[model samples]
Target chain A: MFRLILVAALACVITSKDVLAQEVRITPDTASFSVEVNGKLITIERNQDTNHKITNEFTKTSRPCPPFCIHPISAAPGVTTVGELEVIDFIETSVAKGNGLLIDSRLPEWFAKGTIPGAVNVPFATLEPSNPYRDQILQALGGVQSGAGWSFAAARDLTLFCNGPWCDQSPRAIRNLVDAGYPADKIRYYRGGMQLWLLLGLTVESPNA
Target chain B: MYRIVVLIAGFLIAVSGMLFLQGGQRDPADFALAEDIVIEDVAQMSARTSQAPATDLSGLTSAVRASLSPETVAAPEEADDMAAMTSGVLAGLGAPAPAPGGDDAMQQATAAVLASLNGATAPTNPAPQSLEAIISQSMQAGESDAYIDALLNEAVTSGSVQVPEALMTVDGRVDTRTLIAAIVQQSMGSADAAEIQAIAAEANAGTTPRAPAVQEVAGERLYTVEQGDSLAYIALIFYKDSGQFERIFEANRDVIASPDKIRVGQQLRIPG
Candidate 1:
């Protein structure tokens, strides 16, 4: 019986390895830099997918990428977090403060079902290669370390949170700010994220509800 | 019999396990209710823009005639004459309403037209006017908490609810707080019960306007919009559906005052 168990465990390990070998990896596990926009040190986050090749193949071949293969960027240097938190704590704090921003890194349905009160929707997939709103976000946080719309020289603080520690939204967001040169001190990350927040018994308002 | 029952149970468990494994390899959408971008829809938006001149001419001719006098062209003879004069009249209007330049702009204009035509159009732009060029276009008209709460309560009472969803890409770096506030404000601003009813009815029918769902970057959690970001392309990249740019603007209302005005380096809060 013990031998059988060992064999099964070995098979599971082999299966896991096989799955790992199937993914493509992107460089810069997390990109951090501060672009000097207007004059504030705006922080930014970038989560790299080391396994892009495998994912592409799977997607193209009409196969699903293995679960947990898509890992979210969680933390980096210069993130100031509000609570001993989970993602939900950041959201609750944001709501309690009645001023901070709560970001939902989950898809639309998750957002619609229930989200941290007053949270906005921004997805990680669209971060790079430029979109029109990048500068606007930096301006709100204060100034990009080096990009345009580094407008707003004032050092306004912001709290960043995502689905959970497993979620890459907060990390990538932080990286984007840091890369833009936003001051790290002004930015806080809620590491516990939404998974924790949901677990913490905080109320989530669904757009649909 | 007992042995056979145990064997059957074991077989069932094995089948369930296989199913789970198969499902585990399925797309995220299979396991969870997530947003998906429809590439065809995005392609369609761009196609529509390219075809804008043709559409605009037809629309303008009708609009001008409609505004002038229904009696003038209500008859078949007048209608024939009107059709004959349509091109000349439209040419006089000029430029045929430019295609909003990009997908985001187009989406913004479309939303505005829809709202206005439906009645209950708020100030065309809600953000402080100075920043109009840099802000994301208003997603929904602003709604007050009191009004939203009342609406929600009413929906609950009616045993139906209209929940709004973010259908646009999360690529833009707009303020999340500002976006939600904007949406609430817009919802609250919808003072016309009839228009509100229109939205509610559509939502309840499970026919929330079709838009694309956002996809995640491999191994990354965020993407910042740099200089040269256009709404259409962004929608294509993230949501795979460009028609949902208004939804994106609505989600990021704080930093984005106008969809056409995003500056480089803005940090957008990305939804999954």
Candidate 2:
């Protein structure tokens, strides 16, 4: 009888541990709350609709070339390509602290649809070297303009993202910023962008919503 | 007794092994349920709707017409004559009289005139143009390449135009300026030279000339780690052989720390 009891106890312990290991948990330990952006308290969460499937502008898989193509991982020698976690870290650490900017390098329409929390929309084209407003934009990003010259000593560290890995808007923006003399090391690339961001169950806020 | 003990041990081992196997086997139903919950939560959070906005054709026509200067609008006598001509055309086509003073009627009349000028039927299904089509249409409208460039630059800066995947190249890549140029070329094929010149002159009059192109130096190539990716696999993609994973490891030594360990979303440099 004692031997049988011992065997049963052992089985029970093993089974309990196995069950514990297999149980799935979905809720994040972090507190869910709204973040303030542009003087508005914006609540960030997944779409409440149970039928929400990803049908954003980023849904398309293909585009024409010579303009649209897969981007190289790094925009410049010092520019680091980061993932979602690093982007979140930057947001919590640098952006929240006002030491950096999380830029959504998509056009306004995409920004209106939804974007990462605390990101400011700056379309990639505005940073192009040929753009007449490029200098003004650089200045707004904290570049110091002098007579026919500029300095980026006070420029905020920028983390830029677009639709996702397949999207080139952010990459193009990064390249333009780099070419326009934005410090490469100060710019980080969030390659996962909105696609991966949503896939990972991170919070997104829509200005229109 | 020895035989009995051995048998018991074997039985225990088999039971434990079965438990372990069961533990590892995830129930698909459970996963589906969890996914459903996630979807439900997201849906509750965003309250997003799938219905597209209704197209206001009359509003669009009015906006277009309102953009025209007062000088551009015809005198009352000329307007009356044009109205008579429009009515004659409509009568000839056996169309009914338009509703008196209704915006819809005015919109129809304006649309008819615009259609006749373009030698096309009345517009139907007035969906907004995609960015690609808009850029193409701008080109066709005799906008100068410089003007279009400036317009695109302004639109991007203002966040009015988002990135369109249709502009991506076949290989799933995009060069922003190159894409703009291609769009212009595609649209310019049917554009009038005089209109293009006029728009170009107007755009040039207001804007500083574009600076000369600077020689570009190629920079380091990068690769983002993906799910199911290994150093060897990445090396094979870039080098066409797996043996050079060490080169990748060497380039990304700071971030990688070890070749055996890499995570999705980590960016690694591909050695030139």
Q: Which residue runs of candidate 1 sit more than 4 Å off their true CA positions?
A: A1-74, A81-99, A125-129, A140-155, B1-272
- On residues B124-155, what C-alpha lDDT tens digit does candidate 1 reach at each position? 34333222321222222223323333444444
TM-score of chain A of each: 0.51, 0.77
Model 2: residues with Cα > 4 Å off, grouped in runs: A1-68, B1-272
Lowest summed lDDT window (length 10), candidate 2 chain A: A23-32
Clashes of 1: 105
Which ten residues in a row are the worst by lDDT in model 1 chain B?
B133-142
Work out the iRMS of candidate 2. 18.9
- Candidate 1: what's its TM-score on chain B? 0.21
The top-ranked prediction according to lDDT is 2
Ten residues in a row with the worst lDDT in model 1 chain A? A60-69
Tell me the docking grade of candidate 2. Answer: incorrect
